[model samples]
Target: MRPSTDIDPAIPLRARDGDVEAFAELVEFFHVRCLRYARYMLGEEEDAEEAVQDTFVRVYDHLGQFRPDARFEPWLFRILANRCRTVRERRRRRESLVTTGELPAVAAEAEGMSQDLLEEVEAALEELPAEQREAFLLRHVEDLSYEDMAVITGVRLSALRMRVKRACDTLRIRLKEER
Candidate 1:
């Protein structure tokens, strides 16, 4: 489930107006989630960190371009998602063998979730197609509306829905089998 991660509506507006402290607040508010999402996407801490840093840098560079009428969550996530894709592509082009993935630090965020269960779920998530996994994470884990997801992913609402559905179905089966 997604956390209640909202910030003040004025934060982005303040940041866009060249408020350095506001921008810092924006970074602080989103850093953990951006890192977590990037980690899930890249499956490595270093890559995730790079993606998140790049994402914030880009966001700062382009804050003036952000539409004031729009919500900040989707816009921030859109940049993060793009950064993940870029980092993933770069990693892929390097063609290096990666034998390990970082354990999710957010595992403790889920109260009452067992370590074994978290590992099983992470393994199952890793087995999903990238598109499906991204869709599932954006929709479920990030608690984004389908419309927001469409803006972030550039995928049609139906396609995003289908991807999330397939991911959930696969996860259900995989988790059940693991148990």
Candidate 2:
């Protein structure tokens, strides 16, 4: 009997059978938040996209290894986060690192955001260290609890909290700088 915690039945079963389409469904499910996390951690669209792709490939290879008791999203995010780390290391080695591109041209302010506000948030995210950025994204963007963050990152819970705090402080300073 599958102990249910709200997973798509199609995913684990089909994925274990080497079904690429079922895996693609998983990718589609995670794509937006994964891209956001990759973008924030890697500081570039291309790198983020690559991280997401690499994550999916790794997921395919490791599908059979997934524990039945685990939450799929956080597990997948963990793989994505690790890939982002590797991508960042490679970019550092390459030494021609580029930050995320400018937001698409904003003709008019939407809701409560101005273009400058969007730019400031982007800039702050860009300045965060990779680990800090990953912590931030996992905590706030993905709304994962600190325990979940620890599970995903394989860090102690206290350490994950500290990383999240530092990330928040750094982002606050960066946003302050824009004032």
Each model's C-alpha lDDT?
0.86, 0.77
Off by over 4 Å in 1: 1-4, 93-110
Expressed as tens digits, the lDDT of each residue in 38-123 for candidate 2 is 87777678898899988988888889888766678778878988898888888776432355566455542745677787668767
TM-score (all chains, Cα) for each model: 0.89, 0.82
Show the colliding residue pairs in model 2: none
Which runs in model 2 stand beyond 4 Å of their true positions? 1-10, 93-111
| lDDT top scorer | 1
Q: How far off is residue 67 in model 2, in Å? A: 2.0
Worst 10 residues of 1 by lDDT: 94-103
Judge candidate 1 at residue 65 and give its lDDT: 95
Question: Per-residue alpha-carbon lDDT of model 1 for 21-134, expressed as tens digits?
Answer: 999999898898888788778887888889999999999999989888888889999999999988888776633323255565565557667777877888888888889989
Model 1 root-mean-square deviation: 2.8
